[model samples]
Target: MAGRWTLARGVIHERASALDWAMDSRPRSDSRARECAGLGDGLSPAELSNLTPRAQIAEEWERVRLPESDRKLRVLIVGGAGVAGRNTAASLSKFCPQLQLVIGARNKDKGVQTVSTLGGNSEFVHVDINDFTSLQAAMADSDLVVHAAGPYEYADTKVLEAAIESKTTYVDISDHEGYSRRAKSYMNKAIAAGVPAITNAGANPGVSNLMAATLIHDAQTENRGQPQKLRYNYFTSGSGGTGPGVLSTTFYLLADEAVTYHQGEEKKLKPYSDKRSVSFGEGIGERDVFLLNVPEVASARRVFGVPTIDARFGTAPFFWNWTLLAVMKLLPVEILKDRRIVQFLSKFAYPFIRAVDVISGEKAAIRVDLECSDGYNTSAIFSHQRLAEAAGTATAAFVLAVLEGSTKPGVWYPEEPEGIAVEAREKLLRRAAEGAMEFQITKSFCRRKEKQGMKLGWIN
Candidate 1:
């Protein structure tokens, strides 16, 4: 149950020609060939043509040789005063001690407090993520910037813009679909500056995306059938101790329209609709999950070429779930979309939410299920006792990869081959899974028994 299983049934296409281009430095003349060749295998011509010049360059840069840097890596965590940011700083300090850590916050006192708590080659810097001048000044001294400022629903790409301008590598735990799309739009500028950037690099979007990628990558390497459908199910108990920003984020998501792909077409559905039950296997069992606007839906559909992709999330202290559904049902869209109103409502509900958190305890889990044409089903599950720790650990893993040169120059999603190479995928997964209570990949088969009135049978 702790290890991985493989089943071979379908033809594994040759590893995309992109593997070859990774080493070749000379530029190809034929724009068409370059475009086609730049697209890793399995992508259609239309997908290739949609690539901007910078995105294409970023794809090519994946394999290009990068010069070694003797200077120690410097990482600046933008919202280091907050839970996720502080945890990220701590993880990096403990795991990758060679890298210098800087905690960026608007409040010097909180930054100092965090640095004191983390203690070790860590320092504090004053930075207001919304202020370009402050952000640029902070980025000037850092080699990489980790954006942990929350409630990304209303966040602008100013920090990312500053990163591109400063030519510093960037990573963010943004969960907002619109913000992720906007960050991706900066690919051209990032590539032109020779700076690599990764968006949606946190727990759900980050680890969830990687889970799907791991399954797809393994199937591709082992000759498993093509994945036809991908489903994401997540459960977090009582806000997982992440605080008001997380609550605000949840409220914002409840108001936004959910996006999913069905039969190879994009479909929009009301948030909190399409409820389903998913078994998390062992310690965490079945929970009622509902549709949410998680960024992984879009990333998986585009990168994995899966026709059906969807994501659902549920929280414990079941009444919290009920309350969310009730709010979504009773409130108008205009009021829900208002950030000020949502923040005010979130503040009002904080005490009640915290009371539930006290009893429910902080635990989080993500389950990703992939199905293929040959009746094979594969799953990857990651669970941790605390959401903050899990998210921070995963984000730190990406930071390590970026600092170690695993990532290339350009903006990329966590599941993108260019963002995380197939060769480095296993290593990244291992690093991210550290401290996880359960990390597993399971394989099984289900076949339709036509003779017995359409009965179903399972084969192990």
Candidate 2:
């Protein structure tokens, strides 16, 4: 989710617009299948067929793993002062000790302080997200560029454009629909420019997108004989250990409006006003949820054609979530348009919310449910803290692998099985195997009857 606390009213409208753009811009599954069938223009059928043996691509992807090697890599952490940026940068520095990390931001003091606090082998430089010149200068000679600083509103497309121009492999912890769409809008440009850029590399857009893609692909295969209906629910309990909590909090600030893709058309509604409850996991129990159009729902619907798609949010204190929503609805949507409001919210409200996250540990979880064939259902529950770290770590690892020529180049989202998804999934499984993150995958027998059928017991 987008995480600025101040833009709590009208930001939803902008966020929805961005999400719509990404969903609308997505290439259909059939078209993608055809494109993959070709493997691009250059290779002859024989060469393309032999680019890598089926076993090789699979075995290598699984065995080689991520967080690559000990080689000295110059990495640029854009928005390194922000939560995701610092958390990712710190992890990178720890795992890849040789990485020459640099924090690029408009605020040099903050950047310096971030690197200092992270205590990594890193430095800082000033760079503006909307300024092409500054971005170009900041990205110079960087092996990888992680765009962390964003509200990604109508204004921040240039940072991404500049990344393409700089020919630097890029990744972002962005939940902004527009950011993902704008990034995808340049698919040809990125390919033409010979640069690899992965969008929505954060939680929802990152892991959630990948999870939805994987589940849909499997269901379409397993239930090939029947028409499948996909219903998606992505819920988070709180922001993780990362400071600033910029990623998820920003989405709340923008939650005044509800935007969802219904029957191939975009629909809008008021937020907070539509209160609902959803079961997260077995032991964690059920909690209150509210509508927030996550990028995954629209992307999944477009890619999977799921009739009912929903992305919901739940918090620790149910009333707090409701109150926040009420405030968003009661306030003048445009009154916050004033820069001072954004600044004020950013400075004060943002800190207060972050404090809550810290006090509460921001412990979170996500449940993805898929219904298919003869009313059969399957699902998986993922942890927010683990997912957030994996989003940053695995994304960085895969980007590095792509740069190092370990994976084939192509336009890909986090969920698409081209560059990162496969490798990231493997790493994620290994993490689960190590008991670092307890993730459960289940398959259940479900039956749907005529008018009134048997209903499965859900957590709520």
Candidate 3:
């Protein structure tokens, strides 16, 4: 039997959100039909017939797999024992087995454990992110540095500054607007040191930035239209099966007001407000996403030359989003900003988050919606069954790009043409799409304007 999936935007019924399904099983009884818990929550069927049409990518899984580098570069990954770090390290070893992996962690046991699992040449080094000398020491003799230690909400640029001073190529998974902005400000120093750095290079900020860049580039070069409004909508199930560590990051972001560009001017928007119901292709369906403080919003404004660009993010079991709103209204910003407090909150919420992850099953997707000046809209969508693997693959793509000497000497965002050439964008995305079940980029994905006052807002 076929899988049945239904999505209703802005509504929260976590139990039903996974949807009803049609299945045939060996133990089927004539009186009752079996209900199935869906796997590949984002891409079980991969393509949806009802979705808006686009020229989608079609590549075999290994087609985009990058060649192993013979340079034998050694990469020092700070916080490598953590979830994000481990994922990135796993991908690096998988794609570029020739490169030596240095897993830098404050915890020796965890780092050593992670190193033991990788197939390539790898080792673990002890380093404290807060201690400048320790951080510098870890990357002292390495060819590059990957600052996977994150939450990045209140994180100082100790690692980035150390990277510049040490002249090591740098990449990080930071998604915070403020932290990445400060890192970007170190452009001249990185260039002076003849170092290449890519900040905000995770899944949404990383792969999503490259996706937005590709969309805008194709629009201008191919005479599509003057690219106007760029809206980034991202969806992740439960904690994205990425563990509860991400909770602190999101909770900490509530302290700062989100910023978006408007008509070439900066506009301040309330975090988790400005709700937009977006359809993330097939199985993931439509979700109500709200404005969030993502670095790409501000950085992409400069890189893509767009005045009206903003980012929205929505996560599963819908009440989780509502819970954030509750936290904002009930707690003061100062309390949310406190690292210890947020860490405690994250730890407290882990069991609940873990429960949701079990049902939600780690599915995730990114939809980059671009509204051109021509009034027609073209968009790109990427979906993955596993968020950890996808995030790792995206970050690993950026790491490999920097390793191959593709990025120039400067602290750059993934979307910057100078940092990652438009020509190189496809390859980056190709590698980023490594384990993704479904990914699409089309200059011609269009939607017709619905007659207003008929069935207004998000009905389209």
Listed per model in order, the count of residue pairs whose N, CA or C atoms clash below 3 Å is: 1, 8, 0
Candidate of highest TM-score: 1
Score every model by TM-score.
0.83, 0.73, 0.82
lDDT of 2 by residue, 323-354 (tens): 56665766576744444455556566556655
Candidate 2 residues lying further than 4 Å off, grouped into runs, are 1-71, 117-121, 224-256, 263-265, 336-340, 384-391, 394-411, 419-424, 428-437, 447-460
Over 1-460, each residue of candidate 3 has an lDDT whose tens digit, in order, gives: 3322222111211222122111111122323222322322354243322221122222223322344555667889998999999999988887777678999998899999999999649998999999999988888889889998888877899999999998888998998878888898999898899989998888988898887887676667657678789989999888886855688888987877888889888988888998888988666889989888888888887777787988888888889889888998899998998999999999999888888788878889898978787654556788888888889888888888887667899988888876777677776786787666566543333334644332111113
State the number of backbone clashes in model 3. Answer: 0
Off by over 4 Å in 1: 1-69, 447-460
Q: Rank the candidates by lDDT, best first.
A: 1, 3, 2
> Any idea what lDDT model 2 has?
0.56
Model 3 — which ten-residue stretch has the worst lDDT?
A: 17-26
As a TM-score, model 2 comes out at 0.73
State residue 417's C-alpha deviation in candidate 2, in Å.
3.1
Error of 3 at 182 (Å): 1.2
